[model samples]
Target: MFADGAMVLGAAVLCGSASVVLGVLGVRLIDRRISGGGRAGMSASLDAPIQPMVFLFRDGTLVDATAPARALLDRIGPPDDDWGRLMRWIGPRIPVAREQMQQLARLGRLDLRGGEGQGAATLRLLAEDMGEGVARITLCDPQAEHAGIVVDSMSLQAMEEELGLLRTALDQTPMLIWRQDAQDRITWANAAYLRRAENRHHGALGWPLPRLLESPRPVPGAGTATRRAALEEHGQVSWYDVHSHRTGDQTMMFALPADAAVRAERSMRDFLQTLTKTFADLPIGLAIFDQRRNLQLFNPALIDLTRLPAGFLTARPTLFDFLDQLRELRMVPEPKDYRSWRQHMANLESAAATGHHVETWSLPSGQTYRVTGRPHPDGAVAFLFENITKEMTLTRKFRADLLLGTTVLDGLEDALLVFDSHGQIILHNEAYRAIWGEGEETLCATISAWEARIGAGPALAALRDALGRAFEDRPLSGAMAGPGDRLLGWTLTPLSGDRAMLRFRAVAGQPVPGRAELFEAVGDY
Candidate 1:
């Protein structure tokens, strides 16, 4: 234990001594550069030529650097490691420098010269290990201007050239870029910003240029924020997306023109309004759902048809929720139970997404509604609700009237059969069926078959010819031999709706209903 404590104590003392020596050497290097020379017989001008750039790093941290070296670091921007930027700048020119710098403790020193050319190629780098994990890097250029003892003119020239490049880039860019100080005062602006600001105000802007935008300035450490602002120029308002970034006590602002985006938004809004107006005037209820099955659009008719509350619809409920509302209102077809209703709703959404779906909703209130779901683009679905109650009522009444007419025709003692314009059998009375046989036999009976069944006399042949020709509007009568030689009277007459009726009766029954008598109302029976 005693020996371990002694070893630690000795190591701490050695580290403290190394730190002191390093600080003293740093001060001496700075002093020598500021003065005329460092080595004996070396003049300031001669030393400048040999050492155009110098950097001192201790434990991977930049302790000090010449003014020219500082300017070069700024051009490369921020880096996590202090020496990383310098290593990157020198790596391509002296590929071995990176590996050699890592092994600096073993190598002790390094001298590298680039190719004969301008920039990093024509450069020379000298590295010296100052022990205790400290290193000194010296960059030299024979062609660079280094007349001063303190600062290298070549570094100054590089800084000025870099500044010119940045200036030109900012001026050519179409966006507006400006800087604001701690008090939100405009401190700097690019050429694009100046041109717009001056044109808006109709005058030239001096130092600390005007703050054209009214957005709130970002505070230091706030990172970045973006919003929209407007600038009016000669009664014309122009919009822009303003981006603000704060660094320390100052804020940098940028503006990008947003006129095209704003205009497109307004146009879409207007188009929707027009469509809404058209839908509002339609009699059919309309409801549209997007791909997410959420009700995105609905019309006034939907509320009237479904009896749904306006608030629930405006809340943008899902498709099932809308149907649930209808179910509660008894507007939809009643399901056998809630379980089946849930399944039906699921199928409805699936079927609608795939293709069109139609359902006849018979409400408990005796109202009939036709609900149709049509698939639209982008997986959307449109529903149309139509009230078909009146049309349905008319159809039912027509069916009832036909049933009554058929009953009256069947009650007649004569056999009657009705034929359409196409000579196809459409209707026949019970008496006709009794005489012509029932079912398939009754359907097989034609005028010629009837003539053979009754005995083909001259009068029967004339009647058969009359029936075969184009049915005339006039009434025609004839006699034929009935079964067991019984005489039967037959008459053919035209009926309403492009139909013809042929009737057969016993020769003695009410004299076979005269032409005018056959047309008599059924009440006479």
Candidate 2:
């Protein structure tokens, strides 16, 4: 009785092993019945063989398992639990079902997920009573009743092919793709990343991103950010536009190389530095405004000429604001009316755009400015301010000296004419016009010396000859017959810088005073 009770208890705990033995015995019984007990002729069914998978346990240790079951369990991992270890190997898609199945298995009941080995399967556990203290337990994988339903295998094959193609495309792309875990460790990187790293020994995988970069970490978020990354292996630096997306515990980072953009910006910065240095040394005050009329650049001369504060200029004021500041400081021309100020500013801009504006600002402080506007590329405008105060002063003094000289020459009795090196009668005094009867028509226009000589008659041929000799570094004086029996005296004097002065006197009896006598007369005057 004790042995029989032990056998019953063992059978109850080992039901998974009993199911397998019972299934085979039931098949045999069906075959025997079909044969009607005549020779027990058995015929095999023309169906696919069922791949059996089961594990049997006696007490708490593994006793038996089907070959397929043992192979699958071993492929997953080493067994650590007595509950067949299949529960841990099953996928987590149906976690609740797996847990329930585990619990039921421990209770010695038949329970299974209705799927296995890439198809629908059924697991069964059975216990069979045996003689003595032994019981048979079977864990069986039967063809599921719902296994009649067919699935298209082509869809799975297509999916795998598409996945392979996607991986190929990613590997061939020039840009790099990287995957990171929650701890910011780089889990996977693409072919481009590998090419940049150039060596597998760097061990990018499982390392923090900062280990491969100059910084320990980049700013991370959903938005795209740009940063410069230096490959420590090659010491080559490149810019990258990095975008990140997070899915669960893993983050995907996409990086595109911006080396060309970085190089272009560097070149532009260097060019601007060169331009700034060149403009700094110029004497002309230069102020440049952009298309928006904002003052974008100004030179040192601009600050000195405008007398505006450098701090104010650095604030990037608009053109109107700059003008207003200049007006406030009385550096620019003051407007006649307050209401016309805006119109004046508009006109100034219009003139600048057309490159036709030119104005002189006579400041109250006696400083004079000659301001000019010019159009530049990209709808920009440049203003040049030049301090012409000393220049203007010297020019005015020269003009006054010229007027005084004209007055002294007009006071002389002789007719004076000055000829330039080109033989053009450039300057003729009023006395010459009076003596030669030359009207404004002749005096106001340019007259050649040869033309003047022809108009004066054959008697003045000697005067022309004397003038030619003076040009050859020989001063000449001669007498010639005038229009109505009067004698004309002429003297040609060579002056410096390829210039000559010719004087004529219509003498009543004798020639005009000599150089000494003329100087004495001019001193008395």
Candidate 3:
């Protein structure tokens, strides 16, 4: 009976140990299912086609993330060990979704959506309480569902193309072109800009724009803040007049002011030089004088004509010395009156106080000179001399031509009247005046009154009407004849804006026609 009792006790102990082992294993299996299965369910929901998800704990630890979230996270790198630290660093960098995350954390369960990736992605944050201090979060992405994208794309492309064309045009232009960033850094420059010695970067691409501008030479209008204001306010092109240093040439880039880029197509220097070169090269004895009666400058032609050494004509020569030299050379007539010569000197002094002075004289050699003296911007004086010998000859020839043409027209036995643009008589031969029973002066008055008297009839009225039409339409011409076929041929010729000429001729006995006939007669005569 003692042996039986010992065996029974051992069997009971073994059964009790087995029961405890099975119970412990069942609890462990249930825990594993809860943790792993819960995570899997959350992952499936986050990965839905229309949704982009990111999950974080209350402390900001990234627990789970979707494909789109993963892409953004890649750019920022993985979060740090401390969740709070991660949130603080990245929250401000992303403009969107930051506020949403903060709001969601405040509310136990929150749903919020926003933009990401330069408006390419949409982010959604959804959080739910999982009891006992746990939470699940989800994010969403929606970039494909938006309108106005096509219009935006086309507008952006057009703007980009226009900018590209503008850049190309500026680069090809002769003047230097450049742009600076807000920090005064040289962001871009063209070929002409790079060619400048100071602007060369020695294999480097860019330098500070302010450094380039800090040379001894002053930028025009730089003392004022106009250029800076224009850059900030308009963000459009602005101009600056610059005097830059050249590499080998000693001629400094003197004050070249340019317009806005589009208006800078023409070269101002070339135009000015072309206009002035001919005047500078004329063979005349010319000299520019200052207030002190001393020579300031003279052209090459003047120097050659006068044979005066350069050093002798500096800014301190006396007027008496100049005139004495001219008199000794017999270039000028002997002072017929010394008093008049003195008077001329006094007049020059008086004229300097008032304004410019002009005078003309003829030399014994039949050469004539017209001299004009004008004040300069720098308080100096400029003298312009023109040799009028050829002009005088031309004037004589013109007078002869005019007289000959008049004689021929008068001999033609036709009544001719030439009126100005306003139908006032400019010219009427003796025959025309006689036909109207008026003198030369009377003819002018009579023609003036005829316009008011006849209104719009044969002679004066027809000429006025034709001139009005020609003035309206450019290069217009028309003819009119009288009631009895008296042949009052009228013509209209435009002189300038709203101004025309009316010529009338009696077309009896091979009538002298319009202004064309007058010109032809002059040429033939």
Candidate 4:
């Protein structure tokens, strides 16, 4: 029994030993398989291109930058330096993107973005947590991304150049080109503006237009609150008279362009000059006055009519001097009795305090004048005077002449027909109407109307031509024949610039001496 038990124990020990060996071998095989897979993955990863990258740590330390990233860092100087110093080198040269990595050890995530640098390349930084309280960082270079931005910048520069050329063309135009700021300071003025009277200097930029007229003399409409309100609210075209001591003998009405607040300073002078010429050439007379009612300047028409000597009129002249002179010359017959004179003086006194006044006056020559006075932008007054004397005289003369010539049609025997340069009847005396067998009121309404009615035939055409020549100081006389060879005498005389007077008389039955000599003498007169 003991021997058999020993045999069983020995077999059991051998089998147990073999089983332990097999289990150890199998475990080794599995370990080799896992190691081989790991090696294969590592080899494949290593074979891939070693792309350049930038590694930024959670502690603000940057490392493992690729070759391009290293070059960018070198250009930007050390990253460990103070932010201000770093900015001094890199802020202007790079699209620096800043971001914080949250709990870098646990999150193991990195934010990547493009940044500016020399050569217009892009850089991206990556971060990863290694589970042992340490983190890994990586940076990548993206040259393609930055290339697009470079191309876009070049396109923008080209567009700006084209716009600059367009602006230059506009500046050279004849019209006054100008720009102003919100505060009305002249920012730009064109060359044409520099040639105008007050704007002879090319340096008009940074000057406030109102302040430019800083002379003691006031500018027209400048004192009005309404005008300033308009400028602020609507930015509409506003007209105002300005006088600059630099420009002698004239004050100009400037038409400020609408919404010109953003224009350049190079165009201001041209704008002002254009506005000046347009207003200066107007048919109406314009003048400027100071607070003391002294005349600064007057148009040529005003000068001729007032007969006032030039150069004596200045912004500081006294009002009493002007009125006293008119009285001394007896031009104003009853200067003391002229209510208008007193009213004007009162208005001026009131304007000195409140800033503006308007009035009218009649001269002793039975002429009427309309006067408008308003404060200028520079604290002065501008006066516009219109003479209605000729119209009034014509109205009075027509009334008197028509009343006296009511009768004696054919008996007086003086043929009278008033015709314009175009042979259009303006007025005809009773005898002329009787001879022509037409009513006086049937005369042509206009020169053109007469030409149309006269059929533009040779006789009427020659008559019109002769009338035009006579008005130009040329003598014109001709004989007209009726249907039965009846002789009619004609004479042409100029009445005004383009108007003429024509007369016809029967020469057949009367002793008609040659009046051509008389017409020639009158033409010389």
Model 3, 1-525: lDDT tens per residue?
Answer: 999999999999999999999889999999999989999998876654454445445444556656655565653323433333333223322333445555553566866554342222454456676544455665443444232133587889999799778767865676544433223333344545644523344432222222333323334644222121111112444344544442221212222224554254445556545644755767665565566666655666665545556666654465557655655665554567878866775676457436878776577778776766677654566655567778988998999999988888665445555545454555656455333434233434654655543344555565555554655555544455443344555555665544454445565563534555544544553
Candidate 2 segments whose C-alpha is farther than 4 A from its true place = 1-151, 179-188, 194-201, 207-233, 244-252, 355-358, 439-458, 480-487, 506-525
lDDT of 2 by residue, 461-507 (tens): 55555655667777788877643444777788888888888787877
Report the number of the highest-lDDT candidate.
Answer: 1
Give the per-residue Cα lDDT of candidate 4 at 178.
Answer: 40
lDDT, candidate 4, 145-196, per-residue tens: 2222225877898997997687677546654434333323343344444334
Per-residue lDDT of model 1, residues 371-455, tens digit only? 8999999999999999999988998999999999998987777888777667778877766655653323232357556665666
Query: lDDT of model 2 at residue 161?
Result: 91
Number of backbone-clashing residue pairs for each candidate, in the order shown: 0, 8, 4, 42
Tell me how candidate 2 scores on lDDT.
0.66
Give me the displacement of residue 152 in model 4, in angstroms: 27
| Ten contiguous residues with the weakest lDDT in model 4 | 224-233
Better of 2 and 3 by TM-score: 2
Task: Using lDDT as the measure, name the better of candidate 1 and candidate 3.
Answer: 1
What is the C-alpha local distance difference test score of candidate 1?
Answer: 0.77
lDDT of each: 0.77, 0.66, 0.52, 0.52
Please state the error at residue 512 of candidate 1 in Å.
12
Error of 1 at 287 (Å): 0.7
Clashing pairs in 3: 52-139, 52-140, 52-141, 53-139
